[model samples]
Structure formats: structure tokens, C-alpha cells
Target: SHYFPEMRALLNECQFNNCLHINEPGCAIKKALEEGRIHAERYISYWNILDSFDEKY
Candidate 1:
């Protein structure tokens, strides 16, 4: 899921080939969030879109 373009760029750093960026170990996005590489507000925005996708399907 490339809903978040910034995260997409870091996908290769994740541990899994099909990582969802949620609760997955070695999630590059999560690591970035903790290390200040990614802004918290943008991550929160991602959650909003992720929730909407749940409703859409």
C-alpha cells in the first residue's frame, strides 16, 4: 500500500516483503517516526486514510 508516499520510499528497509506499516517488526516508517525522520502529524493523517479504506471496502 503506497497510500503514504514518504513511507513508500522507505519500504525497502522494512523486514517483510509485504509489510503494511502497522505493527510489523522493523517497519521503516515506525522507526522513522521514533527517530524524527517522519513527522507525527503526517503519520496521524495516514491513520485517517487507513481507517477510511476500511470503510470503503
Candidate 2:
């Protein structure tokens, strides 16, 4: 959770406040990923770590 401040910052640049960064129109994070601004492995690693926390419960 503490690892993604840049992603969080990118959220602010999203056109929609409710953007989920997945299949949504005008999503900054998605756009960054598409533009190669944000590395795919880093994003996937963050999600993998976050998903592990969900499984702990």
C-alpha cells in the first residue's frame, strides 16, 4: 500500500474521480501503462502483494 504513491498521484490526474484504472475511459493509470510510463512488472508486483494480503484473512 505504501509502495504506490506515484500510482496514487496518477489517480489525481485521471479524468474521472471514480476511475478504477481498469477498462475505464480516461483512466490515467491505464494510459500510463499503455504509454509505457509505468512499468508493467512493477504494477503487477504491487497487485500481487496486495492480493496476498486479501488471502491472509
Candidate 3:
């Protein structure tokens, strides 16, 4: 249940409750990534880790 504080804050501001932060409209996380607020490498690493977890379980 732990999440990055910056991501948590952006999620709170997202327009949708079920946003995946990928191709969703009004995604605060995407906006941050586009605006250079969040580093792309960090985000990609997070996604890779999440994908690993999904594959394991």
C-alpha cells in the first residue's frame, strides 16, 4: 500500500477515479510527465516493476 508521494498527489488530481495514467484523458500523471515534472526513466522503471509483479502473481 505504499506509493510515491508525488504520484499519489497527482493521482488525487486526476480527472477520473479509474485512470491508468497511460492513454487516459485528464491524467495528472501524464501531464506531469509531459511537463518534465516527473522523470521518464523513473516512470518507466516503476512500470517495469509493476509488470514484473503482475507476471509473478
Candidate 4:
């Protein structure tokens, strides 16, 4: 949430308790991104970080 304050509240709004906000179903953060409520650039950066983790591990 620190990375994206806009995602803080929506985090809990996700369908699952463990929603990673990556590509999970019923992800509130994704929904907001799709609806243009959240900035696309920030979402892109978030994806980049997650993708980097894949390379590290």
C-alpha cells in the first residue's frame, strides 16, 4: 500500500483475503485500474516490481 496509496483501501475490498493484486479474479485494485480510477503508470510500475521478483527467484 505504501507504493500506491490509491490501492490501500481497495486492498481489503478484494474478493479473497490473500489477493495479490496481480491477476487474481475479483481484485479491487485491478478493477480500479480497468476503470481508470487508478493511474496506469503506477500500475505498470507495480507490475514491473513483481516481474523483477520472478527474475530474482
Candidate 5:
């Protein structure tokens, strides 16, 4: 939860609450990506693999 607090604060500061942190404008998460704070592609790959496991069971 280390990043959540700051992230929440950023979201709270955003113009909207339904932010997915994708390509949305004024998205803090996207800003983090631009700053190299988070890896978008890696996260997507990880989630894709995790989601694939659901079909195996």
C-alpha cells in the first residue's frame, strides 16, 4: 500500500474519481509512467498471465 496513499491523493486531486489511470487525461498513474515510476507494459503482461490462470481451473 506504499503507493496507494499518494496515488489516492492524486486521484482525489483529479477531476474525476472513475479514473483507471490509463490514457485518461490528468491521470496520475499515467504521469507516473511518463516519469518511469511504473512499468505499464510489464503490469499488463503480469495481469494477462494471472488472468489466464482462471481458465485452467
Candidate 6:
């Protein structure tokens, strides 16, 4: 599912440029998670794909 326009806009305003909407510092996505705007599992799962690829290698 796509994020809302307002949500994307909010994410774009993150303090850092490398914000991956993950656990990185100053991440808008993490803030959104704290405020109940995003789900915990979904957030972790997004990054877990990298782990999945690592396992294959």
C-alpha cells in the first residue's frame, strides 16, 4: 500500500538526508511509528528483505 501524501510530505521533512524510514537517527518513519502512523512489523519487515538476500548468499 502507498503512504498518504501528507505522510510522504512529512517524511520528506526529516532532519537527515539518508532517512530510510527505518531505525536510523532522525527518521521521520520512526517518529511516525511512535505516533501510531506506521506499524512496527511492517517497518522491520521492510528492512528484513536485505537479511533475506544475505541468507541466500
Best prediction by TM-score: 4
Q: Which model is ahead, 3 or 4, in terms of lDDT?
A: 4
Clashing pairs in 2: none
lDDT string, candidate 5, 1-57, tens digits: 124443544566455578656456887756766787656675465446646776787
- Model 6 TM-score? 0.56
TM-score of each model, paired residue for residue: 0.81, 0.65, 0.76, 0.85, 0.47, 0.56
- Model 3, 1-57: lDDT tens digits are 026666777787889988877778998888998999988886786677777888999
Please report how far candidate 1 places residue 29 from its true position, in Å.
0.7
User: Which of the two candidates, 1 or 5, achieves a greater TM-score against the reference?
Assistant: 1
Worst 10-residue lDDT window for candidate 5 reads 1-10
User: How much lDDT does each candidate structure score?
Assistant: 0.84, 0.76, 0.78, 0.87, 0.58, 0.65
* Higher-ranked by lDDT: 2 or 3: 3
Supply the global lDDT for candidate 1. 0.84
List the candidate 3 regions with Cα displacement exceeding 4 Å.
Answer: 54-57
Which candidate ranks first by lDDT, i.e. highest? 4
Model 1 vs. true fold: TM: 0.81
Name the runs in model 4 displaced over 4 angstroms: none
Better of 1 and 2 by TM-score: 1
Clashing pairs in 4: none
Model 5 clash pairs are none
Model 1, span 1-57: residue lDDT tens = 476778888989999988777789988999998999888988888888888988999
- Which of candidates 3 and 5 reaches a greater TM-score? 3
Worst-scoring 10-residue span by lDDT in model 2 = 1-10
Instruction: Return the TM-score for candidate 4, rounded to 2 decimals.
Output: 0.85
- Minimum summed lDDT over a 10-residue window in model 4 is located at 1-10
